[model samples]
Target chain A: MTAVESSVATLDPEEARRLRRERLERIGSWVLPLAIMVLAIWLWDRICVWNEIPQYILPRPGVVLQTLYNDAALLFGSLLVTLRITFLGLLLAVVGGVGLAVLFAQSKWVEMSFFPFAIVLQVTPIVAIFPLINIYVDNQTAKLLLCAWIVAFFPILSNTTLGLNSVDRNLRDLFRLNGATRWQELWHLRLPAAMPYFLGGLKIAGGLSLIGAVVAEFVAGASGQSSGLASRIIEAGYRLNAPRLFAALILISLAGIVIFLVLSLVSHLILRRWHESALKQER
Target chain B: MVPSTTVPGMEGSGKPLLSLRAVGKTFSNGVTALSNVDMTIREGDFLSLLGPSGCGKSTALRIIAGLTAPTTGTLDWSRKPGEESSVGFVFQEPTLLPWASVFDNVWLPLRLKGVSRSDAAPAVSQLLERVHLSGFENAVPRELSGGMKMRVSIARALVTKPRVLLMDEPFAALDEITRFKLNNDLLELWQDERFTVVFVTHSVFESVFLSNRIVVMAARPGRVFQEVEVDAPYPRDEAFRTSPAYAALCRQASDVLVSAINSTHGAAA
Candidate 1:
């Protein structure tokens, strides 16, 4: 019996088949999307070349790439500026959102009085508010940061509040039975349980923060040393430099994707060991 | 058959650790969960509050732990005022913190008492070993089975070495084999520690096998209906479980529970 088991274990056909399938699926996930993207780009270039499209109207993919390469210094500098705004706005939003959420969890009256204001901020379009903000705020960077922070703050606040309130009643009773102080309960029980919800909100806020930064920049139309990728897009549009415009757009889209990916990775790393959402479902 | 008794502080010859005098609870929504609950918990006694659902067994346990306040009664504690920390509670569910490792979950009560992790590690380790979870110290609650999670919960409750341990249907979610194993282990722990235990359960056989005295309760303004004494010798093993005495005690308790449950139905009708 032992000899038979050992021989079967060495050449397990079912195990081998499953491993091969898993490997193929893993490779196909990224490889397939990449191949499709390359093919689409090639087709786009072919169509532009075949039709003799004007560079001002519809530049070829190669021209767009060339424009990106030639203006790397200026474009990359603007990219850094845009990314800085995105990060800074997201940081401020997290601080404000989580801090307010803790206060809301502590007192109902505070939440009732201030939550409607936060809702008004979220629902009121940033574009509509930009002219008013620009009129009052002379510092272009601070105005952009405020707009971005407003856009990103609500999800974190709502999600964190829900997470804090959704604690298991049994666990809360246990904490009370142990004679835990209010601060201790909040710090130990509420905070750890709210982490996954906070991280989920962070991932969403990452994209919104970038959008907020770019939209605010476009509205401001600021040019010169402080200009971001959005401003580059506007400048390229005025000159009818379609390739450069495309390049700037691509850089903004890529930055948004990177932010989303980084936030997701952070969430996964923190929750992988314990949370139900992070656990792999077995058939 | 054991006679039904209503007089408080009548059972158990042991010295009283805590006495509940006319305890009652009425929620804000006007639901009376418990009413005129009078009982005396004696030191080193394994007392089971066996009742049907909605009999306020859990509420009674919670009130004892000071997690909930009684509406109309006094809970007089025999222990010193500063010894309020010497009470541990286990809920119906395992209630282990999913984020923490088994060691950390067991270390929580001690940590709350201002003991550092390093100082609490020895007690946590000893309790984990007692619960047969020695090698699973670093394992998260998610990694454990239902029974194992309950074991961790038990370990955490015992880590503080509380004089009174209140458990509310702690093994209700587990399978029969696991529940039986846990019951035996709990008895062993009780034998060794001699802590005053107020166990709440709905199972007659379980109460019969584990407790020296079982308090049968009724619902609809929950109150005590009867008290049954097992009068069985301790160091009970598989032989005791299979004995005629165990079966007889279970039969008596089952009869009391049935009548208690039926009385509520009769009153409603």
Candidate 2:
């Protein structure tokens, strides 16, 4: 038996071939998507050049890139403002959502009484609320943060509630058998069980928070140093600076992509070792 | 091997550790899980509640562990006051905390009892070794196979050194080979620890091999139908698994379980 095992373990030719194929497949997964994106952009640039499109109507990709490079200081500074609002909104949403979720998990009555308000906040358009918020609030940053918070709050609350409630029944029984107090059970079992769901909700909220920040900024339309990327887009539209408009739009989309990737990476890093959703498929 | 007998509560010469008299459980949905179940679990005895699905064996175990209160019965624990906390339960599934390591999982009960990690480490390590999982302290539940996870669950249950251990079909999900191995290891553990165990299983061979006393239960408002004692001596090993006495006891228990299952069908018909 030992002789047969040693022979099999000595790096067989079939094993080498399989390993090479696996490596190629791993690289191809990422490279293929990037290649397709580059081809699409190239096609867009060619269509504009061939049609003799004016800069105001449809700027060439090079024009848009040049506009981005020239306006880097202004656009990038606005991006920082937008990103600050996005991150602040996301952080506040997490705290409020998880705090309320724990309260709801602790008492069904509290959930029944207050969960409707959350739904109302979710369904009511942030644009509609912004007028009321703008009229009432004195601070501009606070108004934008509130709008972003409203948009990003519900998924975290609902998903976390579901997660806290979805604990295994047998595990609960075991906890009860072991004489675990209410706080102990919540701290030890429910919180950890809710982490994956919380992270999932975090991914959705991350994108929404950025949207909220941009949309709120657009609604505000406050000019000067405090204006964000959305305000820049509005300014460019009014001036008919098409390339600048495209540049600002590109920055916003890039910001959204970065937020999504970062949140996904965080979720994967935390859950990779244990969670079924994050674990790699064996075959 | 000791001879077979029909002694219900007189097998071992000691006061009953726990007694359930006329115990019955009815859920809020009006489903009767158990009815008029009477049993006495003595200290240091390996007991198996043998039945078909929905036979209320698990319900009985739950009631014994005080996890679920019986709707219409009383349970008397022979132990003095404050000793009721020394009860351990193993569920059908492993019911492990997937996020915790094997060591942390085993340390849970002690941790809940306010034992610090450093204080509980030795007991946790000792229990893991007894379950043949000494090297798997830091391994998470997701990394272990079904049998190995069950071993960790058993280790967690035994870590507290409970006076009574209630197991509800702990090995029913395992394959035949794993089940046999766990059964043997469990008996060895029981012999070493001398903790009273109330094991629930549907396998007659398993019940006969691991339990000295088996309570046959019937379904459709499940209740105990009969009691069969295998009068088998302790230190039962693989040799006992192949012995004539083991075969006879298994045949007896199987006949009893078959009749119990048939009676449920007959009543339904």
Candidate 3:
């Protein structure tokens, strides 16, 4: 505290003012959002009270919280199922995306011959392909996982391909000058350069994978013990259990938020020291 | 120093470290980047290829560095039997890997040659020390200022201890003060290491300041125009930069460069 005080005291008036602004910004970034959320939640409760809405139609936030507590085992288990598919799908996408991107980086013929297929797959909606998957894949879990992978794969493939192609010209020449082999060039030059791009895709893919899982389960309509939160939401909707439906939805959104945060953290940890995207914000 | 009295074109140094014999390059687009760029670089010679922008000095350097192939003629290197074909090249920009640390960047050549990081540490550290980047081994390229990045690049280039060090206007982007400081440090390293240098640039003052021999090149087919020797003794400093002898040499080189530029301009017109 003394060290900070001494530094502040040493700063000029303008510098002190700037320092104060920085402190305020740091605190406000967290506190402001929380305050607004509290206000919004209060407003929601007031509307529920004023409308005198019944529990089935528009359950109060308190009732939803109680239902979440009451249905913890069911809701949490369903979230785990959804999260498992999302993660497995993302893992497959990374391996396939990066592997194929490397192939594309190496040979124009390979890329030219098959890149259109990837484009077509990306452009074709997963919903449109659901019927096809259902026909071929008898396993419900595999079907949902495949749908998630398809949704998540394109961003990783395209971003990684772009990054691989964008290797610095001079650095490439340097690698060539040093007699680096094809494998060495890919491992040392292309992969590290593609990391930021790959991570960017990962962040987008994280959320998309969750959405894919939920949407796929909804489309599949396979209800059972192993069914994900999407099935629970559908079941609660059928029973007119608005609080339970809200609880299931809240679980899915929370799971999505956790996945995004984890992916973002992974990106930050990998690139914090070097990448421009992860560098300390001067502003 | 090769006594500053050696003839520009006369043969029989027996071991001209590298000699370009009628080198020419024509791109697929039909732009003749270089033609008949004949020159011989001797051991420990600070030779500069000086001219205007389109003069193909960089192309000639690249050809010598074996980055680009010459469509016509040969680059002959008279290496000793045990010597590997090696040359260090510095690009116009500080092309250190943005993702790699200063030490790792310097360790690259050794790493490419199959040396492990721990094994190459001694050489990397020694070169980093030579370039005054000793404490900055862990810093990435983005963390460095432009001049410092250029310094790291020089260290990386020299880490392999190549027989020839080829620089393509390595300090062109730096401010004048930083450029001068780097010039001094480079000369110090040259004096210490005694490696042959082939520096390419358009600035006559810089060329004259650094090189004992400056080969002025012409554009529009980029060929050698003239060769001017500095005839100045080493241990050159600010005293030398302000001296009448240096002024005369700069004037002579500048006149040659202006003539080369005008000739290219006339051809283009």
i-RMS, every candidate? 0.8, 0.7, 0.9
- Cα RMSD (Å) between model 2 and the true structure? 3.8
What number of backbone clashes does candidate 3 have, counting pairs of residues 3 or more apart or in separate chains?
0
DockQ for candidate 1, please give it. 0.78
Q: Give the clashing residue pairs of candidate 2, or none.
A: none
Off by over 4 Å in 3: A1-17, A222-226, B1-14, B266-269
TM-score of chain A of each: 0.92, 0.90, 0.94
Model 3 RMSD in angstroms: 3.2
Q: Candidate 3 chain A, which ten residues in sequence have the lowest lDDT sum?
A: A219-228
How is the predicted docking of candidate 3 categorized under the CAPRI scheme? medium
Cα lDDT tens digits, model 3, A63-155, are 999999999998889888999999999998898888899999999899999899999988999989998998999888899989998999899
C-alpha local distance difference test of each model: 0.89, 0.90, 0.88
Better-scoring candidate (DockQ), 2 or 3: 2
Off by over 4 Å in 2: A1-24, A222-226, B1-13, B265-269
Compute the lDDT of residue B180 as modeled in candidate 2.
Answer: 88
Highest-DockQ candidate:
1
Predicted candidate 1 versus true structure: per-residue lDDT over A1-283, tens digit per residue: 9998897799679987988899999999999999999999999989898998899999998989999999999999999999999999999999998998999999889889999999999999999998899889889889999999999999999999889888999889888888899999998899999999999999999999999999999998753425899999999999999999999999999999999999999999999999989999876
